[model samples]
Target: MSGKKCKHCGSSEIEVDPARGDAVCTNCGSVLEDNIIVSEVEFQENAHGGSSAIGQFVSAESKGGASGFGRAYVGIGQESREVTLRKAREGITALCQQLRLNQQCIDIACNFFKMALSRHLTIGRPANLTQAACVYMTCRTEGTAHLLIDISDALQICCYQLGRIYFKLSRKLCINIPPTGKCFFLYHKVANERAAT
Candidate 1:
């Protein structure tokens, strides 16, 4: 502590939450300071010799790194694109969770979304719709019990557009994921769980 004390309560007891970048007075439970700027760069050599803060901190998502979940790309629109991509990813992840999918299925749906982006399939489409369509496609390909109309209702995506994009994506990607068999869709609950119980 740089001999700095909380101005609110004049207390030395202060806490810093690095994740949220907030410094608070523990005694008064008041915010001492918010948004502490953490510079991304560790060191940099300017046009000369002295070290500077010009290079970025290489996150632990590189190959052979500890974070096997990898990094989520937010794309390159500064703030707007980052927010939009994050929302899309959240939508896909949430929908997969609702479907009671495993991590592998969620990963597959995320990949489908990424593939759609790379294929420029998102150019004239709503991001949310594309995101849900990706998850729906993954469930179909994996032969899960998710139905198209059900996914459409849950995600609030238009059924016709969703089906259209799904078929086009399948054709373009050469993915022949047949629609799930009717027997699998007979129940609205977890099929195997219900059977076992």
Candidate 2:
């Protein structure tokens, strides 16, 4: 391939015929080599690493999936599990700041996160929605007080769907938390006083 010329016509157009083991000159139809052996390299690694021929390098999703927080642990490596937990904690802190919640409310919500995740509450749901539900649920448990509609508005979610997810998460966690303030006086009565206190 590197400027191989035929001596008969001094032509640089030479083609390799592997089956016949001959290098034929495309220009003058002359045989340059009667026999040739093809050489290949040895050793291969990093299958599916998604890199170039020289080396292998794999990347990860920054926010979701197995790489970071907002990912439901369907089963992943220890590194990703730690990352997910850290991300969830950061998300809870951010949501608390948005809702103007106190540290007590944040702690209460953070406590329920593991239980909810362990119960597969976020299996088919967005992790942010589940995190928002935790914050809303904590507000309901503590005296902070926010209606489902208020939470939906803050979370930019539909009230009905948020309420359903909240209920399902509560039931799965086997919690009997009582609602406080204006929310309690409206629809559902306080379920458990001890759980709330």
Candidate 3:
């Protein structure tokens, strides 16, 4: 019942509902204000015989606790590891699709990328390079007909750069890629001979 007058009926009589956190005008039956802050402080008893505030200010978009809110915002700083992994997965998927690779190949490529992330091999490296390397590794391990040059062409990057990442990733992961077959060598030799002619 403060001296605040209601704009609807100019009535000075207003009742504040603490439970609903609102103020209403009694004379005109109009809601004056809502979401009013109440001075009541709530607390909970802890196992240590201490009292603490009842609830915390949880952000609706934060996925920190068990409340299952949502993903937290990165907010004007370096991206988090999860964000980087997500981007890498997307990039790897796109590159695999561009190569017309099958689902199994895509899945294996994603797994390779995940393993690299788990081992922290992707740190301080371009995400696309890591993605391309993972895809190339998948192609090799899955025995797909794709070459490193195909991935490099799809990503529009230098083959040497992709090759460096590919070799580094293979060595770090201890993956033993199969050597080129005799037919592949003969084909390459014939192609080179034709070009020389």
Candidate with the greatest lDDT versus the true structure: 3
* Candidate 1 accuracy as lDDT: 0.69
Q: Which residue pairs in candidate 1 have backbone atoms (N, alpha carbon, C) closer than 3 angstroms, thus clashing?
A: none
Q: Once superposed on the true structure, which residue ranges of model 1 sit more than 4 Å away at CA?
A: 1-85, 185-197
TM-score of each: 0.52, 0.52, 0.55
Ranking by lDDT: 3, 1, 2
Instruction: Tell me the tens digit of each residue's lDDT in model 3 across 1-197.
Output: 48899999999999986544468999999998765543464666779998754322334443544121222234423235556777877888788789888888888888888888879898788889999999999888877666777688888999999999999999999888987687765665676589699
Kindly list the per-residue Cα lDDT of model 1 for residues 1-197, writing each as its tens digit.
45779887799988876444468888998887654545552454657786644212223433332121222223322333345556777888888887788888888888887777767777787876788778878888887777788778887768998888888877777777885655676664576468779
Backbone Cα, N, C clashes tallied per candidate: 0, 0, 0
lDDT, residue 2, model 3: 89
Task: Give the alpha carbon lDDT tens digit for every residue of 65-154 in model 2.
Answer: 222222223332345545556677888888788778888888888878877866667778877778778887788677564666666777
Cα lDDT, all candidates: 0.69, 0.67, 0.76
